[model samples]
Target: MRAMTYDTYGGVEVLSETRIPVPKVGPGEVLVRVRCASVNPVDWKIMAGGLDGLMDVVYPVVPGWDVAGTVEYVGIDTPEFTAGDEVVAYARKDYVHGGTFAEFVTVPVRALAPKPASLTWQQAAGLPLAGLTAYQLLTRLDTGKEDTVLVHGAAGGVGSLGVQIARALGARVIGTASARNHDRLRELGCEPVEYGDGLAERVRALAPDGVTVVADFVGGVLDTTRAVLAEGGRHASIADHTVLGAGGQWMWVRPVGADLAELGRLADAGQLTVTVAKTFPLAELAAAFDLSREGHTAGKIVLEV
Candidate 1:
């Protein structure tokens, strides 16, 4: 199997392409023939040791969590899927190693979902981590039709999906982005607000009473979240742990097959969509990391295997 691996934690320079043995499938796992894998900020962050204290690392690590691929072989006892099944997964394991950024990767059945027929491989690849992040956050907040929800960093990968998911749940969505992305947010059924100076006022202009739910996708917006939340509102942050101090949930997306399958159903029903900002070949993992690190792309950065 061809994979992008790093022997030690460092910058993008630590990543290099090499041929390694095909990972052995264990019971309750499946070996997927990789088609496309999406890049998340956490990919590079993990590569650079940002998660050193949170997750154990193994050397020669293959770094990626989002996968869209075909099941080539299913391990014993894994009866949920079989050969030739098209699937997508948030393929993170308990340890940092043997990931989706390769020709082949083994995924536990717990994280795998059938791919939606409406999406291309690249789009499906982009769905798992970002889509799950938004879905789980909104779910935890118990969003509903009567609520006016505000999304921070609404044009980026996770926020884009957050806006759509909030709308699908029947909530009125106000999304924060740059002026250039406001129109895009509107297309996703969100009222767009420009983020920056007076962000609170802009959001308040749309939801005069206050937003019933706040989801912060980009960090450093605790103040803005505080400014516009309704008196009994719920809030959460994927980027900022300080949210915990503010009566908000600090979340890390979990790989639940049922949740991913629900997202697949949303895509198939035309209630959800993924934006692909750019695609790179598997060998260009480092370059992809650079683009993701730039933090300017509005959609997902994917690698076509």
Candidate 2:
């Protein structure tokens, strides 16, 4: 199978197209013929050694976690799916030896969910990781209709979905984004606030009582979160583990079939959607990683397998 591999932690230049044996399906795993895979910041972060101390890695690492594809084979005892089933998965394994940027990727059945019928392969591939992150954070916070939610980086991959999911849950959303994305935020039913030195003041102008839930997808806004939060408000961050010291949860997204399924259901029901900012062919994984590293794309980048 053809896959992109990096022999060591470095920049996008380290990624190279190579042919390797297809991964064996371990017990409770499935072999997916990948149609598309999404590029996330974590993918590049791992490639550049930012997460070196936190997780073990094997050389010639295949780096991607989000996949939308068809099941080509099922592992022993994996009865939840059969060959030829369409699926999407947040295929993060315990280690980083193999991944979805390939002709085929192995997925644990527990991380597999049917792709949303309303989404294209590119969109489905984009949904698993970012969509699940937003869904999990909001659920963990128990954000609900009565609450007013403030979403930091609300036009980002996870933050954009956070805005939509909060709206679906009936929360009043105030989203912080660049002025360029303010209209997009409004389309998703959020009160758009320009993110800058006066972000707290902008959010305050929208919600005089302050927000009840804060979901920060971008880091370094802890004080701003404090400034705009109402008493008893809950907050969390996916980017900053330091949040744990300040009464907020620092989250790493988990690969859960149930959670992905819920997100898929939301997409199929028109309650949620995934946006693909750009795409590259499997061999051009380096270029895709470059785009992700640019850090300004408002939507997910993808690799077509």
TM-scores of the candidates are 0.99, 0.98
Q: What local lDDT does model 1 show for residue 289?
A: 94
What's model 1's lDDT at 216? 93
TM-score of candidate 2 on Cα atoms, chains taken together: 0.98
How much is the lDDT of residue 61 in candidate 2?
94
* Candidate 2 per-residue lDDT over residues 1-305, each given as its tens digit: 99999998889889899999998989999999999999999999999898889889998899999999999999899889999999999999998889899899999999999989999999999999999999999999999989999999999999999999999999999888899998888989988888778888888888889999999999999999999899999999998888899889999899999999999898988999988999999998888888887899989999999
Go through the candidates in order and give the clash count of each: 0, 0
Off by over 4 Å in 1: none
Give the poorly placed runs of model 2, Cα more than 4 Å off: none
User: What's the residue-level lDDT of 101 in candidate 2?
Assistant: 90
Model 2: colliding residue pairs: none
How well does candidate 1 score on lDDT at residue 170?
96
* lDDT of model 2 at position 164: 95
Ten residues in a row with the worst lDDT in model 2? Answer: 193-202
Root-mean-square deviation per candidate? 0.7, 0.8
